[model samples]
Target chain A: MSELVKVVVDAMGGDYAPQEPVKAAVEAVTERKDIQVILTGPEDEVHAQLAKYPDYPKDRIQVVPATEVIQTAEPPVMAIQKKKDSSLVVGLKMVKRQEADAFVSCGSTGAILVGGQVLVGRLKGVERPPLAPLIPTEKGVSLLIDCGATVDARSSHLVQFAKMGSIYMENVVGIKNPKVAIVNIGAEEEKGNALVKETFPLLKACPGINFIGSIEARDIPSGYADVVVCEAFVGNVILKLYEGLAGTLMKKIKGGLMSSFRSKLGALLIKPALKKTLKSFDVTEHGGAPLLGLKGLVVKCHGSARSIEIKNGIFQCVQFKQQRINEKIGEHILEMADTSKE
Target chain B: MSELVKVVVDAMGGDYAPQEPVKAAVEAVTERKDIQVILTGPEDEVHAQLAKYPDYPKDRIQVVPATEVIQTAEPPVMAIQKKKDSSLVVGLKMVKRQEADAFVSCGSTGAILVGGQVLVGRLKGVERPPLAPLIPTEKGVSLLIDCGATVDARSSHLVQFAKMGSIYMENVVGIKNPKVAIVNIGAEEEKGNALVKETFPLLKACPGINFIGSIEARDIPSGYADVVVCEAFVGNVILKLYEGLAGTLMKKIKGGLMSSFRSKLGALLIKPALKKTLKSFDVTEHGGAPLLGLKGLVVKCHGSARSIEIKNGIFQCVQFKQQRINEKIGEHILEMADTSKE
Candidate 1:
């Protein structure tokens, strides 16, 4: 077997907390011999959940007790500063100390982002670390870079996001020469606000990426580009709106299907195929948002993530480590710097 | 009947052009007695379309000759400057000349916005003219302000949008003291970028409006707010993405329903109920986006609008005139200016 990729899992984070994390850790270890999980939380709480999975690999799973829990509503900076013994902080610290190859958490996005930047630190030559997530599209999936982290970003930061996003999609997602597109109000070159206008040419002129021109928000769901780039505020709105609209539409669709006896019967006939189609679009089927450009890998899952999502997040980290994404990013940034210098 | 609300129709605008616009003009006159429409395009072309509805109310509709047309892809500033005899320009000039009460078009959004500002002009003390569209939601419709007109908006501009949105919703849409919310990444006050952060406190402090705190983009489709305010870029993305996603999902659903024989049969049985339910969520059912704060009303129909939507757009203009929306806006801005001075 290959060398193990040790991933630290935050057991005290997310809506389901220790139970889902513990279950996912067990699932991860059982599915692969080349991966190990370090579970961090209150010892007894984690142990009680772990007890239910008696057949889990003993050597591959270990517990790291941390008594404190960081609440999602607490200010991220303050929580990271005050709660050093919290599961989130401990997991991040483990990555910083080189005790783990990656850290996975379904914690407060703010806390994880702050800890990822302040503790694990950014890779050399990175302007700002971005939270990039794989969003399902009609064709397959596209990586939306800078969804939340680095909200007030400049054009230079956006160009870097495009480059890094292309790298992640091409290597991690296995798409060759992945197309990178900047999210804009119009497909026209002269349209958009100051930030997008400034970033457009920079991205167009950037080297070593398939930089497709501006993409309207309407084309995003059709999967027109492999990598979608934008500053964090616009990206965050797009991500949340996408999720929100999908949920609303699903509810409305269900309500429509149940309105009459004949329709309900029709719903029953279409349920299996429709369910499968909807499940494919479910974001949790994909993994967590990775804080790209960090020296060590850190992944932030949804706060409401269940065991399946948690397990997928763990597997995502394994892939990241296996592909040496951070090292590749480091080398790419250096090449960019050298080109700029010359 | 009440005083006639004279609306100029851009016969050379939109995907369907004279056919849809002329049909809508004839339909509007037949549907109501208190409205008149002036069709502006190549005189012969407008007359040719009008000939089909010869039995219709000839007295309520008139033809205004214009020899030019503005393409959607043309630059807004240059188009407005150069296309002097264009249908859009001729229509706007009528409003500016007080020969028309309102201008309705399924034309270039950029050109209409620019023309509305440069021709019909802004009401005194009005900071910016917002393009407020009534988007269908679970409960009813909510006005999404500044979807395209002003992209890089200041806090003051946002506050103005909020106030104008409230006035229009209450007076035009018949919602009493409509709940207003600013779109943000998080529900927390301090969670946004510089513009939203500055606008939050100002919105909170503003009197005579129902000011709700921050609303995440996820909560928007659930009908949580009657008036949703954002700068243009974010709002445009939200609007387009909503439309695009709905279309994509509908296509996917139709595909799913036809994937199997059982599903195909079910689709036939449920087709009527499903169509009715889905039609309620159709945005074009609501009407065109109104260029609020313009001295004379300017309604922008979707570029792909059919006769029904254009007819709805004409009716929307009638309602605005009946409600005296522009007058109310003028008084509200005066009150705001007085309060700020105090």
Candidate 2:
């Protein structure tokens, strides 16, 4: 039998907590026999949640004790340092020690960002580790890199991000020479500010990837390009606004449907199809965002993530492992660096 | 009657030019007795369109002669400087000379931004002319500043934006002591980069406005904020993403409803309610974004705007004039500058 892909999940984190992660882990292992999950949290709470899911395999699931919890309010660096037994810190250590191939968490994003760097460390030649998420676009999906991880990034970092993001989308997401675009104010090369103008030429000159000129944020969801690269500040804004607007619009639609008796009846008749359509827009189905340029894989799920989100996150790790995404990224980086040296 | 609010519109601009703008102008003048519109384009084209609506007051509508049109492809600066008979340049010159209360265009955004500054100029103490648009929120709408004018802005400029945006929202939009927030990666005061960190303290120190701390983009449409302030780069991203996602979701919903006969029937029954709900999310209904901090009022309608949008853009000018939003913003700036001295 093939070796099982071990994933360390921080079960004590997130709004849904042990229930969501535990349920998701059970679902993932049941669906895939080649994976094992280590649920890190209070042992008793983990087991109690596990007892509810009687159909889950006993050997596939194990509890790793992590008594302390990191609240979102605590300072990131300070929390990671002070709470050594926190789920985020402990799970990250497992990935660093190679006891698990990857770490999945819905914990405080700040703690995860800090712990990922302090514990798992960044890959060589990577100036900053970026949080890259695959957002669903009209044409399948595109990767949005540097989504609120490293702020105040330089132009060179953005150039590197385009390269790293290009490697991930091509190798893992399975797009060939994916169209990489620098997120800018306008499509014209000369349209953006200092950072974009400087990075545009560097991205265009990149040898191994397909560098598209520029993409405005409005063009993103239209799936106009395959890879969208920007600094963390801009990326975060895009990701969050996408989420907020989707949620708001859905809410408005529902409220409008329920406004009158005739509309309410119509809403009931169309509920099934509407539900199915809306499901595609649910961000949780895409899983967690990967901390790109890391030595080991680290995915940050939403803090309010539920069971489905957790399962999708584990599935993401499986894909990352099968594709050997990190190794390919590292090789690509070295190749680019060597060429630049000459 | 109150002094007639004269609004000069670039009638030759936008996708549905003479037809839509002419219709909307007639509607506005007929509905509001205190407003008059000067439609600038070819006199023959304007008169031929006006023939469709005989009930509209002939005296209330006047045709100004302009021979040239500014295509979106034309270089904005060159079009403004060289095309003396162009609708955009001529209409803006009217506003600059105070022959009209405001200038409204659904033409080229780049031309509007450039023309508003070079032709109309900025009010005293106004560092940058920000494109402030009223975005649909759960709590009606909130003004988002610096949507696409100034990038690479400084702390002082942002502070000025907060003061100006706050005044516009409260006075023109009729919100009281509007809550202003600097769009940041996170909510913490120390969370963002140098610009946000520096501007945070300054905004909080300013009087006459309810200064909220930083707002993440995800919190925008949820009505968690009233005025979202940021540099043009970030603001542009937010505005574009909002429009794109809303459009995509609406399309998906329509597609899903038509996929099955039952759902299509349901769609018909709920069409009115759905239309009403969707109208709230429509960008056109909110009118054009004002280029705040400019000496003369300038509003930027969507490039794809028809007559209805043009009408709203002109009507927005009436509110700007009635509330004297610019004068109040100027007064607030002096107050803020004096307070800083103390």
Candidate 3:
């Protein structure tokens, strides 16, 4: 491994693309001495964006040239297969070759998920790789595993997700034996469908994690669980609903606040406090979803990621590396197997 | 068939039973001339509660004796089977025997769902009876079908839910050719789990209903579709999240508003207009969930339902009767079969 932690970023990927990624890389490298960033994109555009930041430290960030770009609308697996010279492909190749400690992208989720599994590969003993994202809750942010990957997922995959997610939360995120709960329609153990019902008992029996009983989707936003578990379909629904409903309610609240003259004045006064409180409930600023149970670290940020989110995504790789999260996860999986044998 | 649209209510059910349901019965009789209520519970207890309302039209609200009560913790199917004289069972029997046009309960959802199907029975050719609830949306209240009834549901069942929900929305909720959408993780036709993938084409070809394609959970609060279709698991998660997150946000906003004196003054000015807007998003104040596709209507209100929700639930049955909703639904199902055959 390199002395300085190296993170490969898809500079041509998000909606803001080269500009945001370029700015984030400069900020990340400038802010930390033990980290380096490799920007993968067309040489000219990436260099032009980097040149705009004249005062930024130039030595810590590198630019790698790629010939093609993956458009958002293109088929994900096909795009990854066809555009081997694209920024996403080049970045993944860097991680696979161990030239980069981790890869960060604000590209197509489908492409990232497909390429991560096909190229970087899964960890030994892992049946499937899960995409785990951190969601802002009332207490703090909670990690939701299998949010988009592994649709029609079986109970065994859910068991692995719990173990991998628990490891990440404990070692990297630094939560102490994080409280894990399976998402069910009701809190009762017997209340879920076939998948949840079968997984509930296995999760309870999981070793080395704080396993709480089943939790309903309603209780999620209240910070009731440190790690919320579900298959891809249920997890995706919860994630999207959390985003959509929170957004609509915030808009409605703002509109309500602006309806009258007195309310507008009040809105002005409470603006700072409201922003602070809401920031605690907004997790997108924290970082991106990590494709866990993989051989190497891979983080997928939102397609619309800006500088803060992109920078945060790059920074999380330092923790993953310094904490040796992947090695610990491999050890945990073996430990779980040994425990099950007993 | 009766001169008035008669609804039997379980007076001993709910968290505030014998009080809220009793008061709601009185209110319903006073509000509408074409409706009557039958209170089924312990004769003396129900009568003493009704005596508190001295000026109520006593003749329009009748009392029927029931000796037992089904607690929320009892096994639903077994409770409906064993509790022959319990308020829930007796109330359902009244509808089964054609003495009442419908039955309303604020009791255990399992018991209500069990008794609604086992006792009141399904309309001819109805495969599954679904619990459909009106959720407050930005545009208006939208009906979410099978919100908790049919867990582990099949694709064919989803197709039927779409048809049934569309009919109810058109006739009862007064939406014309209501747009039906199956709940999905993504809007793309090919993107979803096994159930939605199978149900999409079936709903698209369904007769006598307007079928839109897939809808993401995030788009739900915007009222993108009049009838949101899903099995109980997805629907329940959506409903509970909608309630829990919305409640949490409102509390957080109120806390923010009350943080300072200036905001407090602003709160007073925006109170009425805010109240009006928020009320449009509060579906509980409107009514309860209806166990549709039953021979006779059976509505399950919230356990904490008070006078207003109970009164509205009783009132909604009048429209179910006058519009001949069940008959219309039966016709629609037959038409779908004929279309499939062709």
Candidate 4:
């Protein structure tokens, strides 16, 4: 018989707080009987929210009281160091102490990033643990690695990012032998800045994953590559820009539809279809980005995440553990490093 | 009497080549008699394209014979050096020799960037010439500086980029005291990597423009700043991503609208309003990006530029000339530098 996968969720982390996280926890446990959840927050608040979900099995979910809360604006390192009893830190501690199989939070990105490393720690030989998100594209979605997880990265670090990204796409995403590409200004190898210039050749030579040549920012949405590797700075810019543009475009489209009566009628008729199409592009439909290379899984949902996203993030951990992604990643990277040395 | 602004159009550059450039030249001359265009390309081809436009004033529009074409793939420095008679080089040389006030091209961006600095020369105390493009935003448009022309930039170079961006926005775009922000992962000054961290305080204390704190990429489309400054690599990623996302989103919207009969009907009804709204986000409606800090203006239109875009780029030169933008930029940056040193 298989053991239950214990998932630790930060109930006080996101904008919606205990309501959404507690609801998502109930939804998760109800959906999968094999899953057990430990909700960390103010015990009374969590219990009250959980009581709202009457159908959730009473014994399957438990609450771990965390007395403190970290504001998203607070400095990350200081918060992580100071707030030991906060939901974010306590959840991460569950992963660190092996009380839970995985940890999920919608807290401050900086706090999650810092706590993931300081608490969950890194796998042996892992240089950096990148936050890799599955970004929707024309051909479906691609993995964007190192999105502000590690900045001012060297060529070797980027090569590792490509490998870890490839592992996530291949094993977890179920994309067989994902094609990896380094982001650059132009497709030509000589077109990038210092970091990309130095990393291009090394990526081209890195075996195991199918390493495509350079990918321009223009090519990213075309689904030109399954795994797009970049330094945290570049990746962060791309991610933020992607979110910003999608939102503005959506808002404009709605405004356009409301400009006239005829268009308003049309908008009503097509609302469902348009909503569905736009939903495909929404990153929230997918789970939070996992801070890969950590000893135990540390997933960060969006700060504004609600129940659906929290639920998805929880399920993502189940899949990660089921596939034994960390073991595969550790092995794949170590083998690549050895071959490169040889 | 004000002298006419002579713009040397690379008649042989771009996908449509002499057809678009020549048509644009005729349109420019007809629209404003004070504008003159010198078309540089093969003598016969330029004349043949010009012949199609019989209404173009012979005095306002003239053809300068050039024998060669620099393929987009040709090495930039080598092409600018060896292909002296090529349309791009010949046109740049015309600017260098003061035969034209500006050079407009839809040719290889690399060649134009290289030739502009080498031939047109930099204004005194300009550390690096950045290609600044006015990108459409929610409020209006924001200037994105250092879009891949100069990379591996230092904090000093980024400060210069911010100053030049501010000058262009104020003197050319007609924004008074443009709000300038350095693009970073998060809004905090301490959030960015090495370059941004170093540049943040310097820009804050640098007097001239209205210096806002760091702007995340998500806030860019919301028109958070008039001038967005970054190192060339980060700036290039933001610019390219902006273009790519807009294109991809537009395509997806069209596809979604055509997915069903209801959506198709709605699309037909909303076509006019939607078209008008989307047109505002189109970068081509705005003029080409000027390689700022050069003696003579060099504007690079999109490589796939059509007649309308080519025409707008040609007229953009007239405003730059009338406003004496380069002098304003030189004075603004030099003044800021002096204050910072003190």
Candidate 5:
């Protein structure tokens, strides 16, 4: 191998950090011989956890020293500026200076989003960077772009999002000609507000991407389309609602199953199958959202992410790098921008 | 008793209609002595369904003459205009002409929304009418205003929605000072787009309404606020997401429970308690959404509504009429408009 794909992970970030990230990093390095993981945090805490995973290649994993941790309550930009020695800031710097192929953080979302933009920077011709999260559907998973960034997005930005998102889904997710759609108030072409009405015709006109017409929120869980595109405001609503409702319903069902003696007996028999089925809907099984249209790959793991979530997020970076998703996105975005100019 | 509240029912609407609406009409009139229902549809179908319920008071449930039915596929404005003698059209006209206290239809949502505005007209000083649906939550049900109508809403329109929804929740839902929150991208007061930013201060300044700060979609099911307000586009997404996610989760959980022998036994004992708990989350129990800020009280039931949904919808009309929701909304709107002018 010419060189190992070095990945920097903020081990001190998230709710179950130091433990979860350390465990996940150990697992990831064991599976992929071509990958090197730099677990950035205080060295002693990391070493203590490493002892638990004696089988993981000690040579493949290295500790990068960092002293600070960014709390959720701290101001995003200020924390990034002040906490230069923080795990999140140090990890981002590695990606910026080209010491690592990608940066993974299960830390504060705001700080990650800010650092991704201010530090790593955007790819050329990209107006706004979108947070594209892969949501599980009956048919598999679909990409929801601009989940929490660029709230007041324009039609041009949406057109760019559709193109960039299509590239990633096809290259990494293995979908051919991923069907792209603009999330709207209705299914009809002329049914939405000014942003949707203006963007509908543009999305339809874009020749390279498979622009499916409008998609209503109700059709999303049914996997009506592969790539659902919208401004951050609408996208955020869809993503959060999916999370909240899923969590609420799952809790209700679990409570109902344990309510009585017969149900308790029934639960014992089907516990294995129920566990398997519920695992499929678990959001943690899916990796962190990728901040698309960036110069280099950046993924924002959930703030409360455990080891499995962190490993999945880092694994996502490996695929992103292997497929050269960034180069293709940059090329595609440039082509669209040039054509529009002409 | 001051004359019984007469509710016009579209007997030919919905999937199981003529039977479902007729059945619900009978049940509603039987249960509540203070209400009379006029069944509007082809006489034969209505009489055939009525024949099954001989115990129903014939005088309280009379059939109105209507020949045509508005199919769900028909264009809303075209159907309303062409199908003059259609059950939906005739039923709405009764409400407009003051011959009925309210109109309940499990028919075309588009037709109802269009007809409610075009035929019944909006209240004076009302910029746009909103479809306010009562969504069941952990605390109770909340009124989600502008679920389908008024796409490109302005600050003034949102302010009016807050006033109308607050009045409805207070008088009809029986919540004092019903917390009103403008749906936004973030919870902070400084967050949201141009429309939300402009409307926030206006809502806060209004005298009678209890204007709470922003509420994200995740906060909705947790019952963080009682009255949620948004423009039609956002509100439609919230409503559909709630329905889609709830339905999908229920299906997944049921599938999981039936997958094994032990779980099947467990499911049986807890089935009763589970049923009771799930029933509380069902949107049908809450009935139809009221088209707020309209000159007359208009309620739009789901297209696939069954007997229970129809019955609940009609019962909701009793509360609407009793609380005089329309009059209160009209008065609030006029006062706000007058004050804003000065």
Candidate 6:
């Protein structure tokens, strides 16, 4: 039998709470013998939810009772520190103690980010851990790093993000080399604000990574680069705007198609093909965002995530473990340091 | 007859060059007797292009000879200083001398921005001029201020932007008490970078403007705020991404519809309705970006602009001149100072 990849699931997090997490855990363990899941939440509630899946592999799934549930509205730092027995904190602790290879949550973004950093801790020589999410593009998917964690990141931090992002894309996403590009307002090296101006040359000169030149936000959807790097504020704006505009446009298109009987008939004929095409662009199918550069992998799924997203996120962790992504990142950082010295 | 709003057209500009500019100028003159257009370029070329439209309103259109042309790749400051006889520089100089009420260009963005500030100059007490472009939204449109200008702007500069954006939206776009918003990664006041945190309170306290709280980029396309304000970098990302993602999606939709015979038939039936719905989101159907806070109005159309965009840009300048936008901005600046003192 193959070795099991142990992943801790926060059963009481997200909008759907213990129901979605418990179902996802059962589905994950039932589908794969090479994986084990430890669900952390109130034991009675988790067991009740898990009871629905009678055919789940009882030997692979375990429950670690966590009595407290962290709400999404609480302050992130304080919640992580105070709610020691909360599902989110307890699950992160399991990762910290090496009891689990990875942790997955669909809780408040702030709480998860804080818990990932303070509890899981950063890898040695990693300047900052970036939350890199796979955004849907025309060519497939591209990783957008620093979507929320570090707002005022320095140039050195950006260089580290590039190295780590390249490793993630190459190993987990199965892309070779994975072209890295810095986000800028214009393509010219001298055309950006002070932060971008400072970072551009550093990224251009950095060794061990295939650093492409600046990419404007306009080219992102066309999949111009595999890994797009930017400060957290800009990255957040790009991610959110991408979601907002796509949603708005899709709704408008649907409204247009339903306005008249002729178009309505047309919509019926194209519904199946259109659904398949649009489903590829759905972000949830791509899985959760992984907080890279951590001692152990930590994935933050959307708060409104369903069972499908949670299942994908679990599978993502299995890949992370199988590919040894963290080990590769550690070695890359050491090599980068050596290159800087030479 | 109403007074003629004289607008200077940069004939030696954009991808289509003298032909499109000359044609647009002729069309503008023919469409309205209340407007006159002065074409600036090599006299022979301008006259030759104008000859294509022999039945155009000859009395309302005129030409001024310019011997040189500024390429888009040249350094903006250097081009504006050296290319005195270039069509762009000559047209700007005309605005500076009050020979025309406004200047319209499909030239280099950098050169136009530099020339507008250096030649026509900022209004009294105006800190920095912003490039305000009307972006099409689900509900009409919203004005995105400082799209490519004023990077690394201060809190005070943002406050100024909100005030000016409010004025432009109210006067030109005719939105009453336009809801002004500062773009942020999160919707909370304390949930932004240093710049947004500092500016939020000031905007809330500042009188004479309708200052709404923070707006996430996701809400921008739904037209949540009439005036969406941000530093140039973030604003540029939002603007460009909006265009890029929309274009990519539309192409993908078309490709999907053509993939099969049933879908193809559906596409044919829905063609007219979808075309009308999609046309409302077209950026060109709106006008050029107006460089606000200038003593004389200057509108910069897209570099790839055609006759339709140029004609709309000409009419945009007429509105600015008719509404006395510059004079209103001047008064707003003075009023802001009085409120600050209190």
Error of 6 at A260 (Å): 2.5
Q: Tell the DockQ for candidate 6.
A: 0.82
Off by over 4 Å in 4: none
Backbone clash pairs in model 5 (N, Cα, C under 3 Å; residues 3+ apart or in different chains), count: 6
How would you encode candidate 3's per-residue C-alpha lDDT over A1-342 as one tens digit per residue? 447999999999889998999989999998988889999999999999998988877888999999898887788889999999999999999999998989999988888999999999988878889999999876667899989998999988999888888888887788997989998987778788999989998887776778998888889888888889899998998988888887777777778777778667766766766776676666578799999878889999988889899999988889998889899888888877777788
Query: Where in model 3 is the C-alpha error above 4 Å?
Result: A1-3, B1-3, B260-265
State the lDDT of candidate 6 residue by residue for A18-106, as single tens digits.
Answer: 89988899989888889999999999999999889878789999999999989988889999989999999999999999999999999
Model 2 lDDT at residue A165 = 88
Best by TM-score: 1
The DockQ-based CAPRI class assigned to model 4 is: high
lDDT of 1 by residue, B1-342 (tens): 589999999999999998999999999999999999999999999999999976888998999999999999999999999999999999999999999999999999999999999989999999899999998888889999989999999999999999999999998899998999999988899899999999999999999889998888888889999999999999999899888888777777788888889888888878877887788888888889999998899999999999999999999999999999899999999899999999
Model 3 pairs whose backbones collide? none
Evaluated on chain B only, what are the TM-scores of all the candidate structures, in order?
Answer: 0.99, 0.95, 0.97, 0.97, 0.97, 0.98
Q: Residue B238 error for model 6, in Å?
A: 0.5
Q: Distance (Å) between predicted and true CA of A59, model 5?
A: 3.0
Can you list each candidate's DockQ? Answer: 0.75, 0.77, 0.61, 0.80, 0.59, 0.82
| Candidate 5 TM-score over all chains jointly | 0.93
* Candidate closer to the true structure by DockQ (higher is better), 2 or 5: 2
| Per-residue lDDT of candidate 2, residues A1-342 (tens digit) | 767889999998899898999998999999998889999999989999999987877899888999999998899999999999987888999999989989999988999999999999988878788899889776778999889888888977887788888888887788987998889988888788778888889888888778889998888988888889998889999998888888899899899999999999999888888998888877767899999888789999998888888888898888888788888888878787888899
Candidate 2 regions exceeding 4 Å error are none
Worst lDDT 10-window in candidate 6 chain B = B276-285
Query: Which lDDT tens digits does candidate 3 get at residues B1-342?
Result: 446999999999899999999999999999888899999999999999998989977789999999999998888998988889999999999999999999999999999999998998988778898999999777777899989998989988888899899889999999998999999987788888998899899888777779889889889888899999998998998998888887777677677778778667766766775676676677687799999999899999998899899999998899999999999888877777676678
lDDT of 2 by residue, B16-62 (tens): 88678788889989988889899889888988988999797778888
TM-score of 2: 0.96
User: What value of lDDT does candidate 6 attain over all alpha carbons?
Assistant: 0.92
lDDT of 4 by residue, B1-342 (tens): 678999999998889997998888988899887898999999998998888876668899888889999989888999988999999989999998998999999999999999999989998889999999889898899999988788889888888888888888887889998999999999887889988899999898787769989999999998999999988888888888888888888788789889999889888888888888999988888879999998999999998888888888988888888999889888877886677678
Docking class of 1: medium
Ranking by lDDT: 1, 6, 4, 3, 2, 5
